[model samples]
Target: MPSFLRWIACRAMLAACLAGIAASARAGCEPLTEDGHDYVACRFDPRSDALSLYWRGADGMPLATTERLADAVAATGRKLVFAMNAGMYDTALAPIGLYVENGRMLHRANLRNGAGNFHLKPNGVFYFGDGKAGVMETGRFLKARLNPAFATQSGPMLVIDGQIHPKLQPDGASEKVRNGVGVRDDGTVVFAISTEPVSFYAFARLFRDRLGTQNALFLDGSISTLYAPPLPPVGGWRSLGPMLGVTAGP
Candidate 1:
């Protein structure tokens, strides 16, 4: 073989080897962060292979989905109050959206924060919802089997056996993503990033599969933001959007 051809072959083999190594490393274990919060920013680990929940904080900051509850917890020192959407909004039962109400899943009033009569809230549990029984719902199919209930909505979703479950997919599809933030009854907030406008059906399915919650809903995406500390300019921890996430601690 010619010297030039031999060299080219060697380089191709090297590139192939590098690519394989990179892929292996990427799949070794789930990615996570621990700047302060108790969960990974954008990764979910599920107990069963059926569904799971995943999240990724800003590059260097935590997403501020629950800023309201976190602040209240630090200030008043009381059991907070929140509302839920369960992945359905409009009067027509259009996928669940967020609304703040205390004691009920679809409360729509928070005069202090200017969220009144609106179908959405700023900070609440953001996850997939069944769109059937509002918050505190069970999967359409899995209700008798896996019976999964989420504390919030912070991951994509999945649908199995004609039922919804909280699940995550790294490269699912553009239609499955929601460009918004979501609120849950328990106060968990999910900041979503979507390549396009997600709908009620798709959102519900993705939320169920990826996040393991049959009743996960959509949250503010695209313009969604996060904020955190110990930021780096060049590489390492960074926020997803312009908003900052500051955990309450002195």
Candidate 2:
């Protein structure tokens, strides 16, 4: 075989190996700082793990904690490997917008013109089904009619089509511990939470520039929470609204 041909084959093999690693990336959450702000991020491939959304459990009450969610998952012969507050909620712990779990649309998409980050124009949804997942602007999602098995709606998209949300200012004053989710070009889902108060601009940049996601949505702020065993726990409120998580076989 020609030397050039052998080199091409080696490069292809290396690409394949890298893809496999990304496809099964559940090693742990990573902590890092970008532009003077600190954050912890985790990546997972929906195609490889059974990613689902949860609200009320078998007892007809919300599973309000990681331990409870874990128990619920264990009941089905699975282990809760990852969990995160998926969206903003009202006073009664109800999703402010669309919330679909296990193919049931509990809360239809809230299209009313209102206030808060959730009502911010261009809010988006994070949804997945079968072997694929995506983050898309709510309008686009509604038009697409993807009908994902599990979906959660949140506001003020961080990044769209590789560009940061137009309204987020680079030096915006408001800042708080925040978390959001994004979908990579390869269909990998990335979740990130700022370790400290960070402006919406920086957070959006974290997803667009650092994470390389074409579309990303801001899940929540201040009450942003995550529960990946590999990393430390984070929950601003006693209980969260819609929860998104991954499960591993028991």
Candidate 3:
């Protein structure tokens, strides 16, 4: 065989071996802290339906709200945790959780434009704001713009993150209930089709299946924000409304 070809093969083999070792090391330990409040924290159990809900804390730690939570699982060492900003009472109410202001809930659409929208849709991320809503074709349209390694053209079926979910489609227009994800009666995660100007609950759900969630409830929606390292993996986090949190090194 040609020397160049042999050398190329050797490099490929070495890369594969390193990846295997890394995967094994990552799998070594998956710890979910118990007791004490975590600035960044999340929970999942073998018995449960691959559930995941993560958030940052006001104590100045990582939080998870608007961003997709599954990516955190693939990240090594970092953990996804959840918290509620009871301080922000009522800001706005989406199809899911209540929006809050200054730790108090408030629901005034005119307050902010991009306040309640998720950019990515199953097809692609659409534009939503300025008394206008954005639209995209589908995954095919978004594939080019999204990170190949992290983003998928199509969303997961069955269960989104371990909870039973329903197949959702976008309801674009003033009926901007465009982004939608579902949960099962037994508590499974179902994702909504991606849409431009994403909606809250676009990739979120809560199920009653897990013992921990007897009466599963949805946390935050578009106002939700997640803070983990290597920013801009899937979506970016903005300082919107109140953020429920659990963090690290706090």
Candidate 4:
């Protein structure tokens, strides 16, 4: 074969391979049904994508909706690709536990016991810093003493170190719209939300068994929602506290 022809063939193959990779990276949320429930699972490579947390705007009020966030990012010449409520909040729409955005701590970690899911023991923190992402028990995270650029603390870890939370019953009666985040083996970030009511055990399995994430943290329930391209708008009665979003690079 001619050397020129061989070089052209090699270039074509390289281009095709690059196109395939781009297609996989662009694959976002998709419907996933399991255990008689509906869910939307979105996957992104954290190592390559830009992930950040948002709460208040210049006005010192929670952005609340994705539309507001989109507009805010647009003003900065960036595009918000996706976003979701990051954790539970109080009546005032403030994060109930640890909340950090852009390397600033907004709320300290909560370790006290109380009513509701946030108090559930073994709660954990989902965080990213130093170009890596992780989910660890709140106590373990505190003990490690590592500071993260973005962090959100929430309760009753769904999957811990490759094992589902012991407190999560296999067939519990209690169920609600739930959402959470997990980190895969390759450091990819996987976010999932139940479109229909689902038990904690089932939701955890989605992350552990299906998404292949060894450690996963529950973000919130009932008020859980996601905003991304091609997904219909989600209306809520109250404002959201902390939110996790992926944005386009400058």
TM-score of each: 0.27, 0.88, 0.26, 0.88
Per-residue lDDT tens digits for candidate 1, residues 126-218, read: 323232122332232223322223233222332333354423333435442233332233433333333334443455544343433433433
Give the top-scoring candidate (lDDT). 2
Q: What is the lDDT, from 0 to 100, of the residue 231 in candidate 1?
A: 19
Off by over 4 Å in 3: 1-46, 49-180, 197-235, 240-250
TM-score of 4: 0.88
Model 3 lDDT, full chain set: 0.29
Task: Flag regions of model 2 displaced more than 4 Å.
Answer: 1-27
For residues 157-229, write the lDDT of model 2, one tens digit per residue.
Answer: 9999999999999889999999999999999899999989999999999998998899999999998887877
Residue 75 Cα positional deviation in candidate 4, in Å, after optimal superposition: 0.8
Residues 1-250 of candidate 3 have per-residue lDDT tens digits of 9999999999999999867644432222222222221112223121221222223334434333434333343353443332222112223312122222232223321222233222222222121222222122333333444221111111222123343333343232222212222323333322222212332223232122322322122222333333323321212334333332222211
Q: On a 0 to 1 TM-score scale, where does candidate 1 land against the true structure?
A: 0.27
Ranked by lDDT from best down, the candidates are 2, 4, 1, 3
Q: What's the distance in Å from true for residue 58, model 1?
A: 26
Clashes of 2: 0
lDDT of each: 0.31, 0.87, 0.29, 0.86
| CA lDDT, candidate 3, residue 192 | 24
| Residue 234, candidate 2: C-alpha displacement in angstroms | 1.9
Q: What shift in Å separates residue 248 of candidate 2 from its native position after superposition? A: 0.7
All candidates: CA RMSD in angstroms?
16.0, 6.5, 17.8, 3.6
lDDT for model 2 comes to 0.87
Which scores better on TM-score, 1 or 4? 4
Task: Indicate whether candidate 1 or candidate 2 has the larger TM-score.
Answer: 2
